[model samples]
Target chain A: MQQTRSIEMGTGLFVLLGMAALFFLTTQTTGSNSLSGSDTFEVTARFDNVGSLKNRAPVRMSGVTIGRVTSVRFDPDTLVAEVKLEIESQYDRIPEDSDAGILTSGLLGSQYIGLQAGGSDLSLQEGSEIEFTQSAIVIENLISKYLFKQDSGSDEK
Target chain B: MLRELYFSFVDFLRTFGALQLFFLRLLANSPAILVRRFGLVVQQVYNAGALSLVIIMICGFFVGGVLGLQGYANLAKFNAEDSVGTFAAFSLLKELGPVITALLFSGRAGTALASEIGLMKATEQLSAMEMMAVDPLRRILVPRFLGGVISMPLLTAIFSVIGLFGAHLVAVDLLGVDPGAFWQQMRSSLEIGDVWEGIIKSMVFGVVASLLAVWEGYNAIPTAEGVGRATTRTVVITAIAVLILDFMITAIAI
Candidate 1:
């Protein structure tokens, strides 16, 4: 009976340890955004095509993520996607003239908002709109345009 | 020439029909056999799960460490060392965690199962069971099959956890990565679907390994030499089956 109790205790410990380890792994693997202190600022970028731009995807500047896309909606009047971005407090000094482009990481990768810093001394405040935004350029559209241009050039020749 | 070709075609069909009949019988009796062999299944699960933990832990740790080191080195070349978490999670959850764990389990458990059952056959113990009105399939094979089915996903879950933690230790403790940043990258990178894929693949692998081992053992000829041959075949066949099934599952899932 003593031996059996010890074995039971050991089994219980093993299970508990395993569960703790599993929970740690799950939390570590899924919690990327560790923004602290609730000092978030919002900004908006309008684009013609978000193109696989998922909500909560990172907003990066110079390959360092400074924010995430909070929500994406279409302006019924303009037929443009109004992407609201949540910028962390530390990266609040983005200039008014900064350009936000919907860029792909690779050929078939997810879309992210890439901010190109402008040479403006006047920094944008919270709730300021980034007006100079470039929509996602589909590779297929670019290829077709290039082919058409080649045909037109051949006719000229 | 036409007569010879017709004979060969008939022979092929006859063999195919025999195989179909065997499979149908196996499938028909599987559930009933499994129900009757519940105790045996529990014992097999206890043996496989408890005995295999230490080796699985060691292998999981080393595999995770190597992945982290290699991933960190490659990403460092491009000044993107932060992406190591993503690489580690992707490799562990999608491919290495399930396949390596199953392969290890097959080596440990699969060989043991085949040899044990093969020995029973060689000693006329199976025939004695038949004389005693005991169904050997229910008494022996079903327990092992059910044990493997139950243990595999549990083992896989354990392996994935150990592997991730091992990578974290190597990256943050051994190497000079910030724990916060490493975890941040990992969290941002992995999806729930990635972990689900590993667990699902492991369950399938468990079923295949157990089935193959039981089949090989049951069909083994009654000789010491035959038991050795069956053991070898069980390991080889199960390993190959695991890889093939891994590919099929990945193709479907992805």
Candidate 2:
């Protein structure tokens, strides 16, 4: 009987420990953060190319992380990538005319959305779309354009 | 040779059929045992989970440290050492945590279960239970199986959390990686779906490992050599099954 009780106690502790670990992972480790909660407002931005910008990538204003990219989907009718940004409610004063650009970190780091606030009287509200956007810079396209420019220059010579 | 091959194929089919039948019986008996014999399951949980926690934690820490070290070295070449946390977390959560835990579980608890049940069979305890009409499958096997299933995801979760801590210790403290970048990248890159994938994989592995252990032991020839063979087979088969299932699940998930 004593053995069984001890076994039960040990098992209870073990189970609790496991639960605690899982809770930590869910809440702390994974970045299901302020953007995921109701304390954020969602806005959409359209890009000709989104490159490798994935969901949950940071949305930064002047290099300060203010939100997350909640979703990236193709708009077949508009023929562009529609990226959803979930901005924290505290940053509710972002101008409606801000420009959203897909920018890479360092030389070969992950891509993130950069918001350059524009001079506008209105603030970005829920469901408002950022009008001015710069698409992701594809390396291959730049290389091909450079090569094509060189080829045309030689042809002119 | 052809005749021998035919016989072996037939034997394989028979064993597979029996294993399937055993699994069915387990599922059938689970609910009743879970309700009435909950204490038995708890005892088994203690035996399988608590007893094994020390080794699991130690291995988790070392494995995480290795991942951090390796990740740092590789990412440093690209001047992206800060991404080591993301790399380690992804690897640990998606692949290593469940796979390593299951492999270790088979080595530890699976062998113990097989040998113990095989010894009981050898000692005629199972037969005595049958004589007393006490359904050994219900009272013995079901509890053990349930305990293993319940313990596996929990163990995997603990392993991953500890692994993250170990990685943090190595990357942030030992190395000069920016702590903010390390954690921020990991948090942003990982999603609930990735965590769910790990949980699902662990649970599947748990069912397979526990079922294999109990099944091997229950059907072992009631002899010393047979018991040893059953224990050995439990480890070997569980390891192979885990790898194959991991591949399939990963492919489907991705």
Candidate 3:
């Protein structure tokens, strides 16, 4: 009976330790490690297709995560995804002319916002709206459109 | 040909009826069975969770390392090697972690549950329990069922954490990914829903494994050789169930 009790205690302790490890690792993995000195700034980009662009999706420049998408919504009038991004203050010197494009990392991969900075003396301020954002190019849609275009051209011929 | 078809149909119906009867018995006495078989639950918890830790840790380490390596290789083709953590987290939490852990547990614990109970049946222990005015389902099956239900999720949690850490070590230490950047990518990519889906899958797997084990064990014929057959069937069925359930859960969660 004592042996059984000790084994039970050991199992309980092991499970508790495993739970603690899980919690600690989860916190460490998911905790934001961005530069603490930077103030938070918001930027908005509108796109036609947000293709797998999830909330809190990374906003990357040169393959480095600089911010995250705070929200993604549809503008019923424009039929576009209005994506709001929260960027760090230190990297806020993005030029007003900088273009944001929805880029696929690979074939059948996730979509992300890739920002290409333009050479401009003027910097974009907080709450600035990026006007020249390109939506994700859906591969299947592109293929269908190409095939349909060929069919139409043949009829015209 | 028609006669053979009729015979096959009859056999299938017979098997189905037997399975239905087993489930009926399980549902009828679930609560009472659970209460009476608490000790067995504790024993199973110890066996499945504690004794299995070493194998789980080893599997976790290899799984993490391989994920990191493969993720890095694929991302490297596009110079996106920095996104390894995001890949690792999404893969581990969304699919690999729960499925692999449950598969391992099913092979180890599920098979054991079937054989232990099957042997008991073969040895006339179940009949003895019945003769002594005890329900075999309550005395034996309940404890194993409860053990499985409790142990699986806990083991899955352990597997997920260990696998993530293993991936981290490979990505950061061996592959030379900046630890800070790796974690930042993970943070920005993963969501609460991903973790919740993994835990939910673990629980479902637990229930599926335990049910399959009990179903196989309780139906075993009273022969020493029948015990081994039940054990093998229990493992195969439980493993397949885990895989099929994983796909269903993934479709819903995604």
Per-candidate TM-score against the hidden true structure: 0.69, 0.92, 0.72
Q: Which digits, one per residue and each the tens of the lDDT, describe model 1 over residues A17-110? A: 5556556555556644355346789988899888778987789999988888999999998889999998988776788899999988755457
Clashing pairs in 3: none
lDDT by residue (tens digit), candidate 2, B1-254: 99999999999999999999999999999999999999999999998898889989999999999999999999999888989999999999999999999999999899999999999999999999999999999989999999899889899999999999899899899998999999988887788888889989999999999999999999889999999999999999999999999999999999
Per residue, candidate 2 scores C-alpha lDDT tens digits across A38-95 of 5889999999999999988899998988998989999999999999998989999999
For this target, which candidate reaches the highest lDDT against the unseen true structure? 2
Q: How would the docking of model 3 be graded?
A: acceptable
Lowest-sum lDDT 10-residue window in model 3 chain A: A28-37
Each model's RMSD to truth, in Å?
7.9, 2.3, 7.1
Tell me how far the alpha carbon of residue A114 in candidate 2 is from the true structure, in angstroms, after superposition. 1.8
Steric clashes per prediction: 3, 0, 0
How does model 2 score by TM-score? 0.92
**What are the per-model DockQ values?**
0.25, 0.75, 0.29
- In terms of TM-score, the best-performing candidate is 2
DockQ score for candidate 1: 0.25
Candidate order (lDDT) = 2, 3, 1
DockQ of predicted model 3:
0.29
In model 3, the Cα lDDT at residue B219 comes to 79
**Candidate 3 global TM-score:** 0.72
Please provide, for model 3 over B1-254, each residue's C-alpha lDDT reduced to its tens digit, 9 standing for 90 to 100: 99999999999899878877776776677777567666666777787778777888799888988999998889889887888998988888768878888888878877887888888888888889999998787777877777787777778877778888888899889998888878877876666667778889988988888888888888777687788888888888878889999988889876
